[model samples]
Target chain A: MGELEKIREARKKWQEKYEKSCTERDALFQSISGVPVKPLYTPEDAEGLDYLRDLGLPGEYPFTRGVRQNMYRGRLWTMRLFSGLGTAMDSNRRYHFLLDHGTTGLSVAFHMPTIMGVDSDNPRARGEVGRCGVAIDSLEDMEVLFDGIPLEKVSTSMTINAPAAILLALYIGVAEKQGVGPDKITGTIQNDILKEYIAQKSWIFPPEPSMRIITDILAFCSEHVPRWNTISISGYHIREAGSTAAQELAFTLADGLAYVEAGVKAGLDVDAFAPRLSFFFDAHLDFFEEIAKFRAARRIWAREMKERFKAKKTESLLLRFHTQTAGCSLTAQQPENNIVRTAFEALSGVLGGTQSLHTNSMDETLALPSEKAAQIALRTQQIIAFESGAADTIDPLAGSYYVESLTDRLEKQAYEYFERIEKLGGVVKAIERGFFQKEISDAAYRYQKEIEQKKRIIVGVNDYVVENEKVEIPVLVIDPEVERIQVARVKALREKRDNDAVKRRLEELKKAAAGSENLMAPILEASRAYATLGEIVDVLKSVFGEFKEIPVF
Target chain B: MERKVRVLVGKPGLDGHDRGAKVVASALRDAGMEVIYTGLHQTPEMIVEAAVQEDVDVVGLSILSGAHMALFPRVLELLKEKGVDDVLVTGGGIIPESDMEKLGKLGVGKLFGPGAPTGEIADYIREWFKSSSRAKG
Candidate 1:
């Protein structure tokens, strides 16, 4: 027999033993996402695999390895701790602290009221101002958010979906104040509204108008900023909302495809803004599966952007993403164990070659992270980059027989998801018909059942028993005075601003919103005119009114 | 025979994140409770109006954007003024326990933390209703 045949025979012999042994040990026979674990992978599993066509080199086409050459070796992945809860000034201080502690970027979290486009003093926004995230009632709050931080230096990511364009305009207005033109600023707004209808549910207007707003932002960003990411298409919230890995990949990429179509319909070229269109994914506790999902996402996006979307540039194909450790995996019982879970998830993000990463604080399962807990989260990333030696190589797990097979399988599964969504008439249509909602509901039900039945064990929750151990972690409490001070400030600002100018700007804003003009420019103008968020939203509401989601199930 | 407890799950204010509200609603329904979801973007007045109109035994408000401090008190106040003081008011979200305690003092029945099981929430509602019925009797 030939040398190759002899080696193949030996591998097959080992595989037979492995399959027999798998019958003995049931643990290796299953995966978290419910995919069955096979005994062995071979050249047969990777049949018809063209390395150049499928797995190209780092920084090349089909960027499944890494988006850039010398990814972390060039410079470590941006450590963006998702911070922003309470007043804008409070969040701004946290931003400076993160940047000072070697963070490469900023991720803004908005409060619920702000997310809904309500002003701080609005009866609706009363207690919510600066609660879950930084409150931005007007341009003043935006200016306070980026106080000393130069907009030209570090990248900032805002996690605002429904009011994304308004917030983006506020961000641009803030940058312009610093004498930096649109071309000099680089960052992303989580402006994905389709996913809002699918999973997150932070939607404002109806689907038709919401898509128009997204396209308007895409068009504006493509023409002006050029470097700023118009939309960070997100799957993080979807997974956190109870989607399995395949659902996350499929639903997220479907949303991406919908955005591309919307941009194209908006008279924008595919290559113009495709490079700046980024993604945000969740790094769950399932190690290899998460890594495989990331790899599959890159490969699928690259292939679709090239062949399907007819993109010419390699940058147009790469899916540069920011990953946050799964908050759902953390437990309030033994909060300390969350640190370990976050570390593993962060490691998975690094291995998956995330362009940037956010290691969730251990206290996240409870409240917003205290400064001390936030520091430990940052240190987790630092240890991975500086100490663990995991960042030393590009795509360290690239050639693993199991990993490659899993990546291929996940890619195939995601394609199946795409087909199913397409059959249901694309993402928006599917969401309207409650397709994605039903899938996620079923997945969540199954996962919850698994936990209840002890089939899937969460340490400290379902399996490991810790009795009456008092946690001594110092929890940060936002002073109740924050609400009192915020109310007073808004009251003062309302008293100071010109009522006539505010009314006039709002009228113009309503008129613009009523027509086909981009509401973002008006929102910015209104903000400059010292318009409060509620005032701007109230104007739009006068025209567009409030969105009422008809719950399907 | 006792009537099945009916609870209304509502998202008040502008916060649009409804995954938690939907999940809790489903869990409540699964636990043999009649759930009237008020959909999204409900104002405090609208929620109270719905609670009275729907004639629910309980009103459960879910908000993840941390607006419960202001919004919860308003909802509770509206319920009292509307002469629906017997209608149990509960909250579920990322509320700090201390705030929950403060809210409790203001007559917010209970606060369910993250990962709280559906059965526990259902049981709490049942017990509250049972006690209310006994007092009325």
Candidate 2:
């Protein structure tokens, strides 16, 4: 008899073996994704699944076990802290601090204005010049952001969408000044605009023009910047926008499929751009579920890329991703508990075989992370990596009954979502009809309702309630003068630069935006001329028009 | 006959972090308030115009980019320009305690912070209606 049949025979004695063993009280009895958890998962659960076909060796087909053979034994996952707040100088200082303290990579969080393609002095950007992240108004701001750092040596990921193309142009212009070639500069642009329409909502142009810009970057990057990841198709914001883990997995992969289809239809070879594609997933508070999510994400991507897209490249089938601990999981009442919460989420990312990870600062729930809090968050990852022995093995939870069951369950649910989205005429058309937004809103509402009704126990929130809580953690305050300084600095840059050259470059960009020319070359020219982000975006807005979201609630 | 509370939830300026705003909008609607959410990138003028045209009883501006200081006052000024005095201009975000006090003195109503219960926000609006409308009558 098979091992499953043997376990089933033993399972028949559950009343004698387990049920009478202990009396249980109220338990949640389910995963956060609403998957029911059984008291025990035996070999009978994994019954008809073939080992080699379903779970191959590391770095092989259907990479469910692990992405690389050696995994962290060969090298640890990149410790990338999402650092940036205040002026370019302040953000630059933080970057230096993180790098000095042994962070392997850098992730930039652009300010609200910069992310939305607005300049520092714009009326809409008055008190928000450098609030959330580094304020990169022009190439000058980007220059100060990377003043002493070597462009080719350290990989950097900039978290900016809607205006990702312009930011990439500025970074390339800076690398050119450093004499670093495009191929040598490696990083990613969170150039996932479909998610913008679906979740984040900082989109500039309508979907059609936005997809055009994405394909243009794919074409340009494949030829020139081979190492640069043109897009990090994100589910981070989707989860933040109120998706369950399964929904986050499904919608993000669906968006990735949309980008692949877009690239192919743009007359580009799937292999050329697909090999450079990457993913970004969020690690919520769910421990085993997150690990299962990362595992299931890999298997689905590998199978679909091979069978569905029929891509011929090995690298094209890998679903390498970056994981950031969930910001939504942090609560302001007992902010310090966030440290413990973040550490577990980070460990899940490691066990899930993330290519890179960013553990959120404890103080993020209140404001931008304080410097000490940022250090603590970094140390959380380091301790897990070095001391805990988590990174010592590959797929340590592979044979676990519960984990494997959850992985299969999540993969099945994701396919159901894909079918639903395809029936609604794929992601773009589904988005146009407010399908993604409504689904996310419903999930978010349900989660909040669960908390309100005390169905879910959030330790600091509803369970161990604290009244009149005094949160004594240091909050990083961005000096109001930073705004005045950034505004004046951008105005000075405008006056100092050659007005004629700036005008000519912007006009050339506008012409390119209107015509069928690839936008990168002209945008790079404008960046070299020190044209501001708002100026460059205004040129495109004139031709492409700004996108106003269709409100969904 | 009783009237439904009408609240206009607006995200002014370039801050696109609307999770709080959207969640609050849904909660208010669930609480039986008519909600008009002006989806992202609305200028102060556009937001006030929508509030006035919709004839909302309350205008809740949600901002997290630390731009509340510049934005809240401008919305108040625009409402004054249109002489919409009866409309309440309450707000919330990651505003510092000091800034929250400053906004209160500038004629904005109570400001909520992160993790402030949605039920509390709904109750505050309901409480405001009883006192203010009763006074007008």
Candidate 3:
């Protein structure tokens, strides 16, 4: 009490001095989620917050500090650079480069042709082969994608959701070629299709079928690929789609909770599969706000996993996430300024103790990052980890009056969102009724209005007087011939494979998809038989049918 | 007769990121146009056929997969082959400058880069049709 009184007196003295200087400064100092700022925190702030219950020791229950006890001290977070562009071989070269340059893991990004379940030669897949990311038309392209990379030793993350089961099957098939059984491989698939519907909108089938496909992967992976994360419930794209940090946190956790309920409903034990359930958060430009968001996300997810779902294992309560710098924050105008923006975002992720980080290139808002830009982006992380002293401490701002208060506030606000969502009949109903969509739309509209009104000043965009700063960095340009080369490769591979065998596999896939049988096995067999993405998707499309977007506005 | 300017907005290939396509659909609809957003993952054949079946005057393809170089020309070639010449074709997403130029040459009416205002795009569509109409008359 004496120590608390002394601290309170000191805080009161400073607050009185500061309050005299600026009348509204105290209130204005609050975090962006509209949480209030407090002058000082005593034990009173953490009242009833049992150490074991609220902020458990790292690697223990609740996992408030982190998933691992030693954290980065045990092993540095995976420095995975999410990159893929221009043909499989080209992306393969980049993968080798990233690994050579000390990337701990590989996160493969696919081109649209591959993402949409189309082969390169498909008329719709034209011009797009190997553009944004690597194009994997069949198991052949997947093989080229991992040409020399060891499947057994190195972990891989594929950012494919709509075709996640298909892609996972392809990767496992690739591993099989490398003589590594599915059990030996370690990686994650961004198989969180619900977020795809609510935010990213890259969904293949309707929600029911999509959830079924995801559960099938979860069921299969739990039995076989125990080390692999079946689904990386992502808030990255949600934030990029114009959600506030609080919305990202709430929506992502809600999606995760929904997934747990889905797994449980699908006749799987929560502890068995919940251990592999991971999260992906977006590290936006708001430094302290982003950090608060991450901390709050961890606390909320832990509480929900334990209290709501009654998850027993410590792993079930832990929210291990990978952070990607916000691509939406980068501006095409004065694009070079994006470097600083990305640096701040990366620092936020680091300070928040992310398990893995991917920083965006300055030129990303312009086109896919060129080699020089990608290198610069990677070097940003390197400089932050090595040169910057930020990483020396875990949760560096843990006890900050502002950060802790905001973390608590964000956790509270997210619960409010969960309650509101529950009232609106949970995430699925909210999505169907366009509640989440409308809320995000309103938030996006508000943010845009603020920017336009100069209420929110983006340095080069508004307030800062950079008139005509020429972007000097070399933008990576993919050769037009890459498309020709990719198309030819798909054509050649299709011709070389056993046509009848492929057809049989495709028919089996259609049959399995049409029926109640798990689609993953047949899809894997199809991939093994050299079935193209278009061929496989066509089978599903014929059976499950295409998704027709309903106008919500 | 005032023919409705029906636009088919599509995201082709495997990239399921459709924020742009959805936003543009909303904007176009707000601008007094009928927008058919053929959700994520449409094939070129599928998109072209939708355009024809819906009798859309514009087919806007929003591709974030960077597969435009491979897929855009094929869509255009398919549209031309299907004898759908009067359709105002456009594409958007993360397109490099060189690729944008190449796509324009291939009869993609416009390439809308990031941060290009929706109002500006709507205006461009209006102006393009006006000039074309004038030239024909």
TM-score per candidate, chains pooled: 0.93, 0.97, 0.87
Residues A1-553 of candidate 3: C-alpha lDDT, one tens digit per residue:
6866777778778878978885552223434443444655665455445556666676766666777888876777888999898888899999998888888899998876676677778776656667678878889988989988899999999999888998999999999999999999999999998887788777677788888888899999999889999999999988888788889999999999999999999999999999998889999877888898888888888888888889898888889999999998888777888989999899999888899999998998777788778888889999998889877766777766666666777788899999999999888888888787777766665565456555566766656746755567787777778888988998898889999999999989888887888788899999999998888888888887766566453
In the order shown, the candidates' DockQ scores are 0.54, 0.73, 0.40
Residues A440-514, candidate 2: write the lDDT tens digits. Answer: 888888888778877788888888978888779899888889999999999999999998999999999889888
Worst-scoring 10-residue span by lDDT in model 2 chain A:
A15-24
Question: CAPRI verdict on model 2?
Answer: medium
lDDT of 2 by residue, B39-128 (tens): 888899999999989988899999888788889999999999998888889978887777888989999999998677789899999889
lDDT of 2 at A221: 98
Q: Please give the range of 10 consecutive residues that has the lowest summed lDDT in model 3 chain A.
A: A25-34
User: Can you write out model 1's per-residue Cα lDDT over A1-553, one digit (the tens) per residue?
Assistant: 9755776888888988877775553343567677887767766566656788878899987888988988998988888888897888899899999898989889998887788777776666666667678778888888999999998998899998778877887888899999999888988899998888877887767888788878888878888888899999999988988888888998899899899988888788999879889999999988999999999999999999998999887789989998999987888878998999999999999999998999989888667899989999999999999999999989998878788888988898899989998998888788878899888877777777677667777788767768765667877766667767777777888899887888888888888877898766777777777787767766666766555667743
Q: For each of the candidates, what fraction of the native contacts does it recover?
A: 0.56, 0.70, 0.58
Q: What is the DockQ of candidate 3?
A: 0.40
Model 2 ranges with Cα > 4 A deviation: A15-23, B134-137
lDDT of model 2 at residue A365? 70
Interface RMSD, all candidates in order, equals 1.9, 1.2, 2.8
User: Which runs in model 1 stand beyond 4 Å of their true positions?
Assistant: A1-29, A39-44, A498-504, A518-520, B126-137
Model 2, residue A447: C-alpha shift (Å): 0.4
Among residues 3 or more apart in sequence or in different chains, the pairs in candidate 2 whose N, CA or C atoms overlap within 3 Å are none
* CA lDDT for candidate 1: 0.84
